[model samples]
Target: MGNCIICGKPVDGLVCESHQEDVVFEFDGNSPSQLTPDRYYRGTVDGYADFGVFVDIGDHVTGLLHRSELDRRLESLDWEPGDTVYVQVLDVRDNGNVDLGWSIRQTERDFRGKLIDAPDGEHHPEDVETNDDEGSASAGAAADEAEPSGADDETSSADDATPSADATVPNGRGAHAATAEPEPVEESLAEETEGGLNRTTVDSIGEQVGSVVHLEGEITSVRQTSGPTIFELRDETATVECAAFEEAGVRAYPDVDVDDVVALQGEVERRHGELQVETEALEILAGDERDAVADRLEEALEQEAAPTSVDLLADHDAVSAVRDELVDAATVIRRAVMETRPIIVRHSATADGYVAGAAIERAVLPLVREKHTRDDAEYHYFERRPLDGRVYDMDAATGDVTSMLEARDRHGEQLPLVVLVDAGSTAESADGYELLAHYGAESLVIDDSRTDEEIVDAVAVAVAPSLAGADVDDVTSSALAANVAAHVNDDVRDDLVHLPAVSYWEDTPEAYADLATEAGYDETGVSERREAVALEAYYQSYKDKRELVTDLLFGDGEATRAQDGNLAAHVSGQFRDKLETELETATENLESRDAGGAEVTVLDTAAFTHRFDFPTTDLLLDELHRRRDAAFTLGVDEDELRVRASDGIDVRELGEAIREAVPDGGVHVVGGRDGHVEFLQGEREAVREAALEALEELTA
Candidate 1:
């Protein structure tokens, strides 16, 4: 038997199962079957095919690296015959065909170690034990691992048998890894006690660098990277990352996952300014011990997840109506942060949506930092995604499902708590909510749009006050979300003070306007920020843009007011210029007619204006409707129609009437409260005329 070259663990070959991925292997095997699947190997370019590139593994084995598996297009490959490349063996067919996959790292330096897969390369532990010359923290670990399993014959106490003999460890970190001050790994080797290993909380390990410690906690998550399996462990104190390398890109402790209570012993090390545990051994806890750890964690989470007290930013009847529901929404978000379940906020890509998302983001980010021990946890724990409209349709849900599934399957992340802000209240999002429900994922809807009651049962939390007979018009989504954000953390209550005001483009409430003034933001400041956000929200509507958004809105830095004003003026200027251009074009082509004493104006958006431009059709439509003195205004596009009424009208009822009048018009209502309708492109002209006739009927 040989031993692992790095860890000095006994194995049948040069490397153990855990360290196999750490070492890059040069395939010298005789046949395709001899090539181990899922392991990286060095290969030579034999030639190229229409479907794939032919790569030679050693002398006799040649495999096909299919173009579909490549990161870039097959034709863009810069490889020539006989040139060396690294690849992963994927499969070996019974007929002698080999399937190879792409390896992101092409050079030997990208790997931690190297090994030759030759028959005569078997190595003993002593022969390959790292000498003191290499400056590795694990240098002495290899020697200690080599000692006979009958180690009980030597040391009486576990602490006395500690590896590294309390010697100073030199830094051997790469550019990606952080090097802690050189220090002897503390000699207090954790010993098994009645409660398991000597319990050490994650928060306490910051000052204990280079120490071998025992930690017992619930595994919040596990991420498989190119190098190691990072198990995020959470005690009552805080969550931390414990890396256990089994194989490069392979799961370390496969049985353990999110929420599993486990005990792990490892050396604490610093990586990229973050404290991480280099796991030596880890196992799932069971029975009484597991129950105790689990209970402790649960108790702490419940306490941390609840808000102390809450007061609304203003006394508006619309927001006050759903006060209890807003508190519940706040609790859901807080609980998600404490349990390390990610929070994904999907909102309409509008000024109102941006304000709502920013409020929650500002509130929850601080809690994430306090709870999660990882430095980069804030980015992973909270994300804001902007959807095109207020409906979370199947198209949006499909993207969400694909992302969450990959994270759960590949990284062992707990299914996120998907929060819909300023969106997903309508029954149009039913299929999307049901799809998430099918996977046991929880969701919360915080929209104020008119909705069918069926959506209340579809999600975990529905914070739509309109369902409770509250007026939807008086409440902007940002007003509801700002209340929820206030309840999340009292510390950021001041930060959310202006968000509700910023969300309202017109008719700012007296209380909110007063609050904005007290917060040093005049009416112009709020409008500048609102217009600025609307412009930015349109361009890259998909990305979170966390840092930039935070700066534009909250201004976490000291020079924030001046900087925020400067940015707002610059971006909002572009917003005004684009919007005015569209409004000018739309005004020239508008057609108006009187029906039953009501004036109805129509703009042919597809022909008269930029159908898909900086100011989206709906946005431009809103401006035109506001400028007109008509009782109702309609924006008709190639395949869709949008309506605005002085007194809000029901688009669903209008769509039904239109469909009855023109049976082949293909008019279908998209959103009831928003007065959005869709039709077949071929039936646009008929649908437009039918819509006008239907409006005349409604007026009559």
Candidate 2:
């Protein structure tokens, strides 16, 4: 008999029968049947398959790990063949097939106790028993008969009498009382007291830097660097990296791995501006203690995962239709922040798109800081990329996939949640969405554009006004994104009140305009910010200039020239000058043509307008359409054709008419809700004729 390693109770094995499952076994058996069911075993990856992976438990037994048992997609697994892994034996079939279950704890140190399971029997690390019990008895009898008659004999006799010395004298009675085993019990009690008294949460370790602390948490990830093995431990409150080093490139604490609940005693230290712990001792918490730690973390996470209730900023038809989805988007973003998943916000490169993306970024940054213990969590957890066009194209998705894959390989990061704001509503983005889905990355699109029904199926959530039977033109993407941002974090709602007003170039909604005015932004201020953001957005079309954008949109209000020259005021003047100059030149060179019964204004943009200027083609067309009174305004450049019209013209329908008229024009809608189309430059004459003919039919 021996004392249990955990509770210190006397048992036949090193661990008591009650805690057998908590002990990890190294299988030395020759057959599958010799392995115990519901017990974890250290195994090696044999190979992978489409359905599952084959793991070699020992020399003679192998198990199959089904894909359904994995926590994530099989492709995301960073395991290599022959790598050591941990698995639980679920069953051994009559056909010699061993069924295995996934074990989150991958290393030996993750278990409370480790044992060697042989074909003959089980053996504990501290136990002296063997399969040859009869041979051992014979040898012991021979040794007893050959007892020494010198100093060695005297020493052996003294060692044998030590157990009797600790026993209490029997009472003066006919029956002797049983001797109590007090040392093991006392030691167990002392350990329990010490563990409980010194236990600290990971979040609290920040205040205890330079002091020894005991922390109980689950290891989220384990990485072996050139110098040390870093284990990232996460408790209910926060996560910290614990470094354990024995030698360079050598495995330290070889039994510890990802997803193991352990009680670690270490000295908290600051390493390169981040909180780290130099682990002095680590113990795997098992049985009830492990369950208690897991339960506490789950409870805390449950509370954090609960979505905040949405507070509607304004009552409108568009708002009512997408209110629920807005709340859902907010909830998803908030949950991503808590779970430490990166959020990639993709938006169109427009004034409205920038505002929408900026609002979400502003709302999410604080949550990132609040949720994570790392100072760089904002950069790691959130990113904003502006799309050159109003579609989440294959090119954009491919770039995201490449970067995210690199991050995952280098940093062991979870796949990011792709949040599509002001973009990704059309069928054109279906292929891109499919690529993201294949990698099992969650995607959500929030837009007020006319979305294709197919796009709804492509993404996890689609918050488009047209899907709810609301008019697509009645709402802007910025307005929808602003609402979602407000709900994502209500504390930043006041800062976002002016966003919707800046999104609209022409007919700004009365409700949103009033909200912006109440938030201290007048008509001039809102327009100035809009133009400034648009100008800046063009320069770095891909990067999200967080601080510069914040200054432009939410900066302190001052006169045009004040104590500090306002970026918005300065940029907005440049925006007005460039736009006015372009409008004047375009109007001077404009030619009016009668097509059927409608007046059409044709501007040869390539000849009269600046191609690479402050005002983009889309923005110039918008201004020209607003100022020119025509049935249809067509802007033609060397590479593409842009059309803007009155309320009656459906650009999508008109594009189809043009495609039918000029079969070789290669016409298709490219500019999202703005209703711009692209055509082959070689067939420009054919495209122009088709557009004029289509306009005539529509006017008629």
Candidate 3:
């Protein structure tokens, strides 16, 4: 019998049954079966799994602290591998697996005393340190030989590494410090032993120039230079470009590709203000080594890519209806950025699409610059290509596939995440979406158009308010894009607050208009930006124009600065002049007729307006429709039919009626958020007559 450490009570060992909970046990046993249940044990984090954390209680014994046993969120714990933590031994199963539970007492100071739970017997923890110290003296000497003779600094560093004893126990019951494997060095740390070099992180190699160092990380990207194969290695701290050379214009480490967890030994060199590794040896890690690095990066990326709690910029009901869907889309986009997968935005060629796509670009560019070590990473990682129309057709999909496949073959980039903004919510784009999917690419759609139910299965995330049975007429695609952008990156939330309003043409939401006004843009400012983007969208309808678009929609209005808002006004003047001239001609060429009792005015857009000019066919049509005095307005291009009314037009019903009348014309609703009907050019006259008859019957 003995007395408890905390109380004056009798017990079989050092602590009584009631006082057992007051003590922390240092587990030195070789088997999980030897651990006592319901006692707190000191454990080192071995590695992380999706379900739980593996904690090493002894040299051979490991316990799983399931995520359910954690006091807080598993990802929020901030515990890294090899970190010493405290837990309770909940049970030791017959299969030799140990189950651990959360312990309220994490620090040694919280316990009354520390006991060593050995296989033979239990004893005071202080007694084992004398033996541990003598056992580590040989490793201490080995470490001293590998490093400079700063004996005190070397010993303290060695002391810090002592807790994480090798789980393999290769030395057979060795000292903790002697069996401990050092983690990858975080900063300017250099170590050379008689056996080989120690591990150094990519971030630490900046100062270790001209010296051979070892690195352990996942390869985020790879590029073939003329003289060498450049591999971008990313560790917890940062990514460095590693160049491995077999011969000039030849592939080095041919089997190694992106996302491979690797251990690379190379000499660090400074090239063009960036560090590059000239590889000496490379090994693809497997088993525990790969799992450890993968887990670390997975956790890091998950934390970085997790969406911030950003409330919707405005209280618009349509946007509020699908808030969760917005979050899902944003999370997908942010994760793609973190994983170094390129983002290809395919948006409709319009003022709304430009603003929608630009909002995401503005939020994501800064993150791309921050995540990648290379200066040109933003341009390479993010791209925005405008669609000729609102549909993601085969031509666009084929072009995207060719470029992405070529990149994967040549530079070793992962397949991109295609973001369809203001488009691709209908059956028209399903073939294109499926083509991308076959090539292992995922897509996210944020459109305000009426969604086809079948499209839900085709995309990774779909954020269409119409899916939730809400009217999306007043909800511009830019509102959805900007909201998604805010969630993707919270740092640019201030820059995005006003963008939702700038996308609106006529019925600017009072709340959104107020938001724009607060962000230094009034009604006139919003109009000018909208007009400028509309004008520019026509010029290069296929390019991102990142900087120029950023300046126009999100310009800082300081008068001294000569770009941004100043530039918006300059371009908008041209827009106003060109639009006025086109509108005047379009109005002069209008022909009116009585259909039933309603007056329908028709403008032959192909004959009167410039085929390729500042005011695009759609823009000219919208302006004429807005200025029309008649009850209904129709604009006819070569093979296209456009319709507009004060209230919404049911293009589907009208198209059905017209198609019945002109079955030989091959007339169909091919495009537009509301509706745009198209026909075979050779049968334009018959299609137009059928559309006029359909309008008369519908109005009757």
* TM-score of every model versus the real structure: 0.76, 0.69, 0.70
**Backbone clash count for every predicted candidate, in the order shown:** 2, 1, 0
Clashing pairs in 3: none
C-alpha root-mean-square deviation, each candidate: 10.0, 16.7, 23.0
Clash pairs detected, candidate 1 = 18-246, 21-248
* Candidate 3 lowest-lDDT run of ten: 166-175
- List of clashing residue pairs for candidate 2: 109-255
**Candidates 2 and 3: which is better by lDDT?**
3
* TM-score for predicted model 1 compared with the true structure: 0.76
Output the worst ten-in-a-row residue range by lDDT, candidate 1: 165-174
How far residue 380's Cα lies from its native spot in candidate 3, in Å, is: 0.8
Q: Where does the lowest 10-residue lDDT sum fall in candidate 2? A: 169-178
Deviating ranges (above 4 Å) for candidate 1: 1-191, 195-197, 247-250, 556-565
Expressed as tens digits, the lDDT of each residue in 287-356 for candidate 2 is: 8878988898778777765556577777768878988888878878877776667899999888888899
